[model samples]
Target: MIEEMGQQSLFNILISLMVLIAVWWSVQSIRFDLFLKDPEGIKAKGFMVVLTLALTYLVTSFILNYLNWSQTLRFLF
Candidate 1:
């Protein structure tokens, strides 16, 4: 039982990291120059990092919830 829990935790970590990287990649093309006074500054970069983390959290939660819901469908019959 403990081993299964550890495996599940590891799976979640891997999935979250994958999603985070994907979100970061997808965010790189945005036009932050239009909004920030200094798009190339540290503050702008920090904002981007925060935005990526927030997006990743939301996306990962949704995906994990969907997977759990689907797994529960086995009881529908």
Candidate 2:
């Protein structure tokens, strides 16, 4: 049980890191300075980015738990 818990935690961390990197890459690809000139618009964009990351994590975690994909992988290994 302890090993399973550890494996799940590690998987979650790996997924979170991947999601964060993807978000960072997306943000970097966008020309925010050219489009969002207004201070309020910039702030809103920042908030939206944070919200998007949170939602991504929540949705991915929910799907992972529901599917139990990690267990399947463990079995295969």
Considering every candidate listed, which one attains the maximal lDDT? 1
TM-score of each: 0.95, 0.54
- Cα-lDDT of candidate 1: 0.96
In model 2, the runs with Cα more than 4 Å from the true position are: 39-45, 48-52, 62-77
Against the true structure, what is every candidate's RMSD? 0.7, 4.8
- Report the alpha-carbon TM-score of model 2 versus the true structure: 0.54
For candidate 2, lDDT tens digit of each residue in 1-77?
99989997898788777767776676566565665666357686786578668867876677678668665777885
Q: Which residue pairs clash within candidate 1? A: none
Error of 2 at 67 (Å): 5.1
Candidate 1 C-alpha lDDT tens digits along 1-77: 99999998998999999999999999999999999999999999999999999999999999999998999999999
Q: What is the lDDT of residue 38 in candidate 1?
A: 100
- The alpha-carbon lDDT assigned to residue 65 of candidate 1 equals 94
